[model samples]
Target: MSDFTDASTEPDANVSGATPAPEATPEAGTALDIVVLAGGISHERDVSLRSGRKVVDALAEAGHNVTLRDPDATLLPYLAEHRPDVLFPALHGSSGEDGSLLDLLAGLDVPHVGSAGAAARRAWSKPVASSLVRDAGIAVPASIVLSHESFRELGAPSVLRVVQRALVGDLVVKPASGGSAQGVTIVASPDDLPRAMVDAFTYADVAVVEQRIFGTEVAVTVVDSGDGPQALPPVEIVPTDGVYSFQARYNAGETTFFAPARLDAEVSSAVAEAAVLAHRTLGLSDLSRVDFIIDSEGRPWFLEANVVPGLTETSLVPLAIEASDRSVPEVYDALVRNAARRG
Candidate 1:
C-alpha cells in the first residue's frame, strides 16, 4: 500500500495546481432558484441529507437561492407550486438513484442536474451498468447476479458451490442496487461467502458476487458542463481496515484518499478515458462517478458507476474537483446553469 502522505507529495502534471480555462456556458453570476432534494426514506438518508446541505451551501455561496428539501410526499407539489429554475438532487441509494424521482421531475417539466430517468435506471443496477460498460470495451469483473428468491429456491450450498467454482478467487459481494458500500463484503474464505450473501441480501433483494480485483482502487468523476463529459482527476482510496465499508466512506480519517491517484501518466490517461467512456455508455449526464481497480499491469477494471454520487464533505467527487484546480461551488454552479439552459 502506498503511504498516503508520500503519494500526496508526488507531482503529476495532469492534476497540477494550475487552473484550466473554464468551459463556456451560461454566465456563472446568474442566480437561479434551485431546490436541492436531500433526505429520502432510503437507507442512505443521512448521507443524502449531508450531501444536500453541502450542495445548498455551495449553490447559495454561488449566489443562487437554494432550498434544501426532502423527497417526501410534499416534494412534487412544492416543485409544481414554486417551479424552481432547476433542481439539484443530492439523494443517494434507491430513493434517488432508482430513477423514479427523475421520471417524476420530467413529468413535471422540471429540469434537474443529473442523468435522465431511463439512464439512471441503467446505471442504478450494477449488473446492467457493468454489461453496458463491458460492451463499450471496458474491463468489468466476471460475476453472477443472484436474487434472494433464487438463493432460497436453489439450496444455498449448491448456489455457493457454483459461484465459488465459477469465480475461483476472492470475491466481492454487494447489493446489486445501492451505494455507500452499505452491505458490501469481501469474502476471502469460502466459509465467509454464505455470510456475505446474507449481508448483501439484507440491503437489496439482488446480490452481485464478483471476482475481486486486487489493485489500487480509484474513483474518477465525470462532469458534463455543456462541453461534453470530461473526467476529473482520479481519487485513490486506501482504507485503513482494507475495506471501504459504510463507515470508511462516510467517516473522515477512516480512509486515505490521494487525489489524482498515484498512477503513471499512461495509466492515468487510460483511467480517465475509461471513466468518460463509462459515463457516455451509461448515458449519464451532468455528473457521475466511475470506480475502478488498476491491476498490476495498469489495466482499469470497472467496479461500478454512481449517478447521483455522494457530494458530502468526505466524497470522492469533491476531492477530484479540488485536485483539478476547481472549486465545488463553481462546478455545481455550471451544472445548474447548463440544466437551466436545457429547460
Candidate 2:
C-alpha cells in the first residue's frame, strides 16, 4: 500500500552539512539543583510525566539534585521564591510545546533546556514549520489546513470533496498544533476523510491534511550542547498497525525502532542534513526532533518538527542519544549546564 523502495540498502555516503558532535562529558553540570517540569494540562499529561520522571532520574544520576514539578498554580510563586540552577521542561503538547509557558518562564528569567518562546511557537505549528522548511528548499508534503469553523460552516461533505479532489492520494490528517501523534488519522480512502477530519478537530481547532508519501517514517533528533546543533542518528519507526499513533509511540514493543535507519549512506546523509536545516530554519534552540517520511525516490518529506522532543522510555530522543555514543545523563547534564551558562 506504500511506495516503498529498496534504495535504503545502498552504501553510506558523507552527510553534507552534518558535523560530528564533540565527545560528551558529564562533569560540566554537577551538584546543581534542577527542576524537571512535567504533568501539564494537555492531552499528553501522562506522557509528559513519564518524560519528566526519566529526566529527573537521569539528571540526578549525573550528580545533580533534581526534582520533578508539575505546572500547578503555585509553580510561579515557587520558582520566584527558590530559583533552581536550570529548569528542564519535559512536557509535551499544547501549553508545553506552544510558546505561552516558555514565555512565562522567560518572564521569570528561568533558564530552561529547550527552545525559546517565539521559536517554539514557530516550530509548534505543523503548517508553519512545514512552510518554513519547504521554503528553505526542503521537500515537504503538499497539504492544506482547515479550521473547524470553516469545516462546519462550509459543510463537511463539500469540504471533504474539495480536499479529496485536491489531494488525490493516500492522506494523513492530524491536528495542526499538537504532538504525541494524538488525533492523527491516515485516510487511505475518500470515504474515511470526513471521519479523520472530525477526529483531528477533537485535538485542535485547525487540522492539517497532507498527502501521504509512503516509504519509511523516521525521527531525527537534533541536540545542542554549547556547540552548534547537530543531528543524531535518525530513528526509523515501524509500527505494527502501519501508523505511528499515540499507542505506538508510548507503549513499549508496540513499535519497532531502528537507530541509524537502514538507509544507504547517501540517503542517510540527506536525511540528517534535512533535519539540521529544519532545526536552524525554524530557529529552534537547545533541542528538537524532525520527523519525515522518505518517498520511493529516496527523498525525505518533512512531516512535523517537535520543539520539545519526548524523552520517555520508549521515546526516540533517548534512543538517539544512546546511538550517538553518549549516555542519557551525559547529554542531559550538558544541556542543563548549557542553559545555566546562558542564564
Candidate 3:
C-alpha cells in the first residue's frame, strides 16, 4: 500500500505510538461508531456524499450513533480515539473503494462492514476485477487492458491496429478503476476509438476495452449476515437514449428501474445465485451488489461488483428490498446485529 494516501491523509493519533484497541468482543447493543465515509478526493465525491447521507439517515433511523466524515483520511485516527463498534464506509469511486482505506483499517484491526481492502481494490478496477473474477469461473464480457505507457510507447496507429485486430463489434471503454460510470464510453466505429480511449484515460491511467454484452443489465443487492448471505431482488436498468451515463444515474426519472425486473422465476433465481457466487468468488463479505448483463442467449454475464453500493432514496438496492416486501430498517438492523457479534 502507498505510504500516504493521495496527500489528504490525516496524521495518526497514535503518532505517540500507542497500541490499537484490543480485538476483543463488542458488547451487546453497544453504541457504535457508525462512521459514514463521504466526500473522498475522487470525481464521484458528490455521489459518495449523497450515498453517505442516505446511509446516515438509515442507520440513525435504526437507532445507532452516526458520525459522517468527509474527503479526509482520518478514519484510522478516529478509530484509535473513539472506538466505534463498527464503521460503515459509504465512500464511492476510487479513493474510497480502491482498497487503500480498507488496508489501513485492517492494519489497525478495526472491524468495518464491507469487503476487505484487497477485494475492494480488485473489484473496483474493471479490467483487473473482470480478469480475476472471470478466471474464478464467472461469466464476464471479453475485454483487454491497456496501460497508458504501453499505448504511448506503441503509438496511436500501432495501438489502434492492435485494437482493430483484437476487439470485434461495438466496444465499451472505461477507466480500469472506480465506478458511478464516471469515465466510460461506448464506441460504435473505428473512428470513435481514439476519443473513447482519451475519455477513459480522464479517469484512470489504465483503460479497459470490453465487448458490449447484449441484453438488459441488472444489479443484484445482497446482504451477508453471520449465518450466510442472501440476495435481494434484482433491479433492471433501462436508460433512455441508449446511455446509462452519470446524469441518467443521479437524475430522477431519467432511467426506468424495473424492480423484481420483469423476468421468469427461473431467470431471477439464476441471477440471484450468480450474485451469491460472485460475492464468494470475489472474497467479499458483509455486503455487496453484483451487476450482470443477461445476454441474448438468456445467460447472465457478470460485470464487476460494488463493495459499497449506493443507499440513496433513488438507489436500486433499497428499491429491490421494497419490491421484496422488506423495509430498509430491517435489513440495516440485521447488519448492525451481525457487526455486534463480530465486534
Worst 10 residues of 1 by lDDT: 10-19
Of models 1 and 3, which has the larger lDDT? 1
Error of 3 at 171 (Å): 0.8
Cα lDDT tens digits for candidate 1, 69-88 = 77887788888998989999
Q: Which pairs, if any, clash in model 3? A: 26-343
* lDDT of candidate 3 over 145-215, digit per residue (tens): 99888989989788987887788999889888878787888889989999999988888899988888879
Q: Give the candidate order by descending TM-score.
A: 1, 2, 3
Regions more than 4 Å wrong, model 2: 1-29
Ranked candidates, highest lDDT first: 1, 2, 3
In terms of TM-score, the best-performing candidate is 1
Clash pairs (backbone) in predicted model 2: 11-265, 12-265, 13-265
User: Alpha-carbon error at 213 in model 3, in Å?
Assistant: 1.1
Candidate 3, 131: how far from true, in Å?
Answer: 2.1
Residue 196 of model 3, lDDT score: 91
The runs of at least 3 residues in candidate 1 whose Cα sits more than 4 Å from the true structure, single-residue gaps closed, are: 1-28
